[model samples]
Target: MINKLYFTSLDEQVQQKAFRAIEEEQRSIGYYTLPDQDITPILSYCDSIPDMIETIAVIGIGGSSLGAKAIYEFVKPLNNLSRKLYFFESTDPINITTLLSKIDLEKTHFLVISKSGNTVETFSIYKYIYSLQNDPSAYTFITDPDSPLEKYANEINASVLHLPDNVGGRFSVLSTVGLVPLALCDIDIQALLNGAQTIKQSFFNDGYLKDTLLKKAVFYAKNHAQFHINCIFAYSETLKYFCEWYVQLWGESLGKHQRNSAFHVGLTPIGLIGPKDQHSFLQLIMEGTRDKSVTFIKIEDFHDNITISDITLPHLETLDILNGLPFSKLINMQCDSVMEALEVQGDIPLDSITIPTVNEHSIGSLIYYYELLTSLVGELIDVNTYDQPGVEAGKIILKKKLRVLKK
Candidate 1:
């Protein structure tokens, strides 16, 4: 079942510091407490969804939509839910145009998510959609309480869900940001929380896993100079988006100027789908710059085992050995081979995560694991893990440019 996550060791002082950081984050940030919050609100909202709604289109970017989009795609094929899920994350004209054409406004329920509620891209899309529909009942707003977006939702009499003010967008996946849309689409939101809670207990209540997780954070923080790049090689087509979500979580949370020092410290995150990327990026990992650490994630059970047909052409008869093997086995072997090659070649700090299956519970646990790791690493690096000053600075500039153009 893969109930817990295990990682390498750490020094005693590093372990204590990481523990202290976890306590502080739990007390202040509250992301660690998200899974424990009452899901009644989310469930109640889902029940309120109109019977005619056939699709859910989430309108937000980065942390706003990435986590929910990732979760939706990861488990979509496993369950045939009544409603379809789509993401409207970009402002590109072509993307907006194509997505709008695919979904019928009458059948689509829009979930507008942004932690700040004033995100320009999010509001731009929300306004465009509003222009087309103008129905308050068709949309739900999820954001921090009392934000401009919330005020707008109230003005329109649309439903509004509030996220914990302390929880950042990337860290709010387990909160209303993710729960609302996923619960509406029939995902086991409770099971997802249960999975995340399991990981939380293992870290806070259990000693071994606490040290194991802290140790990995310590390794990353201590070796930030030597291993500046953290590459996540996830070996499932279903996990491609999960990798993307991780990239945002890891990069945004950890890339910061030190708390008291002038030096900037951060671990660059890279997400790659395996077997598909093995032919391309594998070359760079094996022989390129020696400043990257690799984490490989594999699924133990895909729940389906369709075998290759046993057919052989005269020239391709040599491939008959794999004719009856399950594609799942081939992909796993490819992952194992790559790991073996990396280990044999040596020098890279390598770790692997194996998920028993891609379900709500496991996905929940995986999401929390990375979130906690990012927090711990940020702690060790002496930075504010929850804020994104660099992104905010860019947003300020972008707004001024747009205002000038409008004038």
Candidate 2:
């Protein structure tokens, strides 16, 4: 039922090929049932957690933390709950020490998310927390079955949830990786999964050219040839991590070497909380010399409603033209109008992604949509979307530096 848009540039043959590849790849992953097994337990556990969970901290890096952060921000305004949520994914001692000092570890519930159960940053943080804990039962592990973290959780009588082996971290949000933290934050995980299902059905029923994910793939591929930099600017503060998650998903998946040619992909993310950035980054974005594309995300509503007021200026007391519109709507309209003008003058291509509301379902749909789009782009560029050899290389180098420093 959604009106699908295809790129104007891609040829029919290329489009068809890309679609087939995406379909095969998505099917191989078993998209629909992958998250089902983990979802129920995560939801039930989240529901069962007592009101004693006043403050929550999630410990993990990259995909583990990014997905939950995105969901927390997106759904926080709607729930109006007061529980404070913090995420710790860095190895920097100062950040970790500061984070621990701010929260009472005994009272706070910690969710340790790592699919492999051996991520150095996650393991390091877990070890640090383990050392500080008078009671290890305060922590939970979301990891692969039979993994070290799962065993450790059992040994300590802590809760454990298994992650699907085939599901990559960037795509694991619908599962325990994303669901548990979201549920704890008072977000509706079912609605988010429902949104994902809706998009999945759309991708399945529609033809290649009519597929939204495929269209997104072709659009990026076409533009990527000219403008190598892709930037995602989310207008809402809550959606900031959504852009961060996307940067990782797109960058890691598409940056690789293929049998035909080398694939080069890069993503730069910027978060803007509305008229705030108008004074800061707008001038540079409007005139700066950069080969990049911008995707602007707007949420239709916010927790704080706007009110209309009449204030007559001394010189404009007789003028009655500025008294009609709601401030929120006015701002939204002004932003759209300005963006349209910028597009016309600068030839800067823009994509607008508007959600009817910010909830679990909308978040699910958006995340899943991006995952599919990233996969399609990877396929088009002949890159391996599931592997990240480059990321591990950095870790290897870092370990050698740490050994030398310890001396």
Candidate 3:
């Protein structure tokens, strides 16, 4: 499988900075340590034979749910899926009402994921679903060991999977948190892990400093001053969720105050779909301010290759250029057309990533790519990438506001 990645504007200095970050990541314990781990536990637990689950609903938000959701979106239509996958990510009442109306509590299994057991959103949604479950035995928990969530799962006799305490929620996708949900959906966990392993192994190679992840980390760090925002557009429908997943991954990891300085280091990531955005957001991105960099992601191959038959109508002779146009080709042409237009008129810098096909392996490789790349970007920017102290500050605010409601 050829994964064609085009990253722009990287020099030797950029490569050097990213290489140092990769070195630091190599020495780490939790996230960078995933490639060496096994996937058997999550896979075996989610197997179809004994459980025979018909649906899996993941209840969580941000990193807790996005990674699994991204992987699911990419691989779902590609596979002859036996089980359905759904998500309850928001405390928004309309979301809760609409999702609850659709699920059949009997055959639907639930995955309640939280890195920390205390997220109000996760538990609130869980409480709602748990109240409705006639067979709560199908519920499972993915969280840190000995966390409140794990303890609660134990009290309910629900199956509990522990995440490494040091692995942040954003980086927990390759771990049990994401794999369990994916395994439940009949995805190939082994191949996915193998793909991740490929990238991990690449880091130890002869030209490790010249790797794609390093190049990307360098690109962001070097350009962070002017291009404060990273605009990601996914051309494929299957990749729409990947864009959302990257938002959390890039924003939370990089958005941090500099060490003992008045300044903060951050990259604001905004996700958009391809041609749709070409109509809506492109107008602004092309002619608007020059403070953003754009990344375009396109899947190289599609399953359906039906060509459009030539159309002949009374006044449509001008449209004959569209004869024998495969819908796939048309989609690709639209992507290229937008890219050309941007290149011609826009000042936004660009990166293009082309995956050979949308499958477990390619998707896994992508997860690893961003995880490692984000870590490297953190290093280049000279900040602690792992911790989310700002996020905690928000939670503290939430606690006080929530307490007032009870009083």
Candidate 4:
């Protein structure tokens, strides 16, 4: 596998729970199977895009935008893409105004994605954009087949990409949600899916699960209560948005209430960029309360050979040791040093995952790895991993608040 997982191991029982999760998920419309989907529709739609379209403004939030954003950010540099992909996900007027100022509506293609198709902030943003360009061809709606957004798209003769009703927004990345934007940007989405398939197939195989996925899921399940926070220290800046997507996926999928019990359960997820945050959040993880489970992610080969200059100033003579060293080496060294320090400090549950490179394949493998881990941990905790009742309740409340404001 291009993505390698390293961690401390656990007992058979926990591993068995992970296996159970895999079995259960196999029967449902779980995201793990998404890699096996035929993406002809996504590709065909991308092929039909007019050559004059220079920008793709994705209108979505949370699961809707994060996965696609993660994909674009992680591997855009690897491919020579000419079209710009922007996100219009906020209700903040300044955010909308700033995004609007960047692109010409005439040359921009909009992808309005909302799983429920009734997302308040999503449609609110879309409504404003609609005012500027009501041309159906200028927009594509990615939503559930019969959703209000889909109905509206059909009425306007706008193009439509359907999300499987069972697939949640966070898990819908391998679906049309992420693939459409990625394919439009000239990304080899099939390669991304193939990478995910490699992991998924290996995971389902008898031998591969024991060492990697099982070890990870079991660690979180066994230590969920004691280690209340799960933090990811991703070393590469390219992984910044990937960490954000992980936060949403891990936080929302696992956090839940059990109807039979009085206590609410979930691990709070924190995302930090390493070397940068090593100066900040790493201190808290090192000496603060022993309530966190940390995962350190490093890219083995950044594929860039930029190096520090051999010249050193009189006052900065101490930094001369790093002169001529590749920045990639320095960053990897920082990641390794941090992992070693964490190991020495002890008590905190820590693991490391190394990716050979930040290509579509490795990014795809990493995405499925986290998604599978979330499912496994949820199984062990006995929570409904696929649903977000708490979030739904909040959405209901927001609608009422908006109605009151309108009155």
Candidate 5:
């Protein structure tokens, strides 16, 4: 599972812990709070998909797309999908054009996901794709009812899936936003939800505050003042997307505007893939700044295994030691080496969450783990972790600028 550590140091004033108790009332632990009794509707929908549906163009951004994308990346290589998946995550023309070039409009099905029906990027991409066909039956919208997307879906005769009022986009990973995309791709939504259920049962039943995820959040909360940056460095490429998913969960949840007498609270989240990042950011992490905490995600078992055969470099005997070494061993060794140096040598604060294997169960647990962790941390800081008012402000400014451009 996940592991963590925390400590305090000083030369002067006070050494008291400076973190608020999480308010249970102000919390929206939707992922765990809500039980997923049956997914037959989701399952049946995927089962009934027409054969012509070849590509599933996931149309959403941020929480809408990130979790689905993360799950697809992790599960795609397993060849467990009904349709080839594509994502139109942003308004960028290159992304739209690049994906469009490869997809067949006649064969492609659009899964437009937006918690708030009026997401500019989502509908913008939707309209762009819609313009090519004008076929309402080809589009499926996942958003709140009475929202713009819902109205548009009704007008165009496209299918509509509703997101619950309690579940926000970021926390909607277990909901239809993620499950639909994954189910359409032929991934086991039940297994994913089962993993979520297992984790949820263990999480709350184990003891709320004394839970494992909570303890990890506590370590982070205790260090929020000094070590403000939380670096989640993944050792596996599969987890690269998961890092993106996590930062958003951490940054948006804890970054409050006004709290504790005008004290702004937030942890800067940094994501990295390795041993590739060793060449670039390793030096900075080792010596440059001690203001960050590092957590490495190491996978114990890998599906693909390759070993270096007997290599005869007669002149270079030093390189001979690499022979018979599995690529898995090499990566694991690198992680161990860097962690030893960072902790033993630099005294840098670091820990690792070792996933025994990369599979549906493990990935599901990881998602639930962080989802719980972020919510707990939000409670610790006494901040409303579910809302993203700051993001709304940026959207408002962009709309104002666009309105001005029209004038």
Candidate 6:
């Protein structure tokens, strides 16, 4: 996995600096928040049978919704839960209506998440949902204890969970940003945290050779200068939202300039369901006009297993053809073979990230690793990943436009 030359320019010093920053950030804010840890109470609240929850809705914009969405996609199929998980962050009325139509009002529960409690998009959705139910208590709030949403939750007699003030929304996944909703869905929060801790130790430990976050930033700065696009092609369907989470991370963090240079960091995320993408976007990816870097994510193992017997084959006396290979081996070999072909073609640069397994710790590690890598890459490109100054401008402009329209 480390042989890829996409990051040839990254030196030991650059990597060390990146690692130091990641360690500092983790030290500063990591302990300030708790994610799947201390989540037993939340899970207990959701211990009711599946049939009782006709629908589960999560409401928040940007980081709040995106991280939860990523977790939902990553862990949903594994749990085999019967109820549907719906997200209500989008502004489209049709999409909101379609989701509402499927939910049973009497049995459904809404989890409204917003760190500040007053984000325009999030509050707008909360109002819409409130109008639908005509009872604020029907919704639960996850935000800062002092935020307006917390007060609103109290006023409506709904349940409320407080988010850590020091942790930013994008970095809140390790906190209630992701854990609460996931717990409700019966996901193993403990396992996810364990994975995260593994990643954390890997970054902080001195002897580790591969600093994924640093390598990621170096690769992005170099590749973006050449290819101008960074695409995350997650092989598993469950990881589709992982791409989305990365999109916000990369775009918001690095898409700026420090020294007033003409060039600005640019990255576009395109989620590809592998094996599936081999049919759909592979052609454009291989032969398209744009220069692109692709990151491929694969889970080393899945929670479920399936076996097919050779004896069931229709072909007569086919034992010799299928004698040696196991089904799991065959599937993995096929994927590896495809990757080899892509490498041989040299159509684009690629990175392969294999997860030993997906759980809370791994997820935490993945998030932290990416966050650290992003910061390093942003620093390299002279961009600020820590702040979203551009986003606030849009909000200010929108408020002024709204006032004008009201007049």
Regions more than 4 Å wrong, model 1? 1-10
Task: Please give each candidate's TM-score.
Answer: 0.97, 0.88, 0.93, 0.96, 0.92, 0.83
Q: lDDT, candidate 5, residue 269?
A: 88
All models: lDDT?
A: 0.88, 0.72, 0.80, 0.87, 0.78, 0.70
> lDDT tens digits, residues 1-407, model 5?
54545333331111112112333432544556434648888888877668878988889999998888888898777565668888899888987899999999999888889877888888788888878978887888999878888998898788999886578888888888888888887887787777666667776565442344555666677678887888887888998888888888888888996455577888888998889999998898888767788888888887778888768787888988899999888898998888888886555668787877777777887888778778767766667788889999999998999899999
Provide the global lDDT of candidate 2 against the true structure: 0.72
Provide the lowest-lDDT 10-residue window in model 1: 1-10
Where model 3 places Cα greater than 4 Å from the true spot, the runs are 1-14, 134-136, 207-209, 345-347
**Per-model RMSD to reference:** 1.7, 3.1, 2.3, 1.6, 3.5, 4.0
Candidate 2 lDDT for residue 149:
80
Which digits, one per residue and each the tens of the lDDT, describe model 3 over residues 296-404? 8777788788988877777988888888998877888898778778777646677777777878888888788778778878888877888889989999999899899
**Decoy 2 TM-score against native:** 0.88
Once all C-alphas are superposed, what RMSD does model 6 give against the true structure?
A: 4.0
Relative to the true structure, candidate 5 reaches a TM of 0.92
Q: Candidates 2 and 5: which is better by TM-score?
A: 5
Off by over 4 Å in 6: 1-10, 27-54, 207-212, 259-263, 303-334, 358-364
Order candidates by TM-score, high to low.
Answer: 1, 4, 3, 5, 2, 6
lDDT of 1 at 17: 71
- The stretch of ten residues in a row with the least summed lDDT in candidate 2 is 1-10
Give one digit per residue, the lDDT tens place, for model 4 in 244-331: 9999999998899854676789989999998999888989999999999888888988889999999988998998999999999999
Per-residue error for 52 in candidate 2, Å, reads: 2.2
User: Model 5 Cα displacement at 102 (Å)?
Assistant: 1.2
Which pairs of residues clash in candidate 5, taking residues 3 or more apart in a chain or in different chains? 22-379, 81-185, 82-185
Tell me model 3's lDDT, rounded to 2 decimals: 0.80
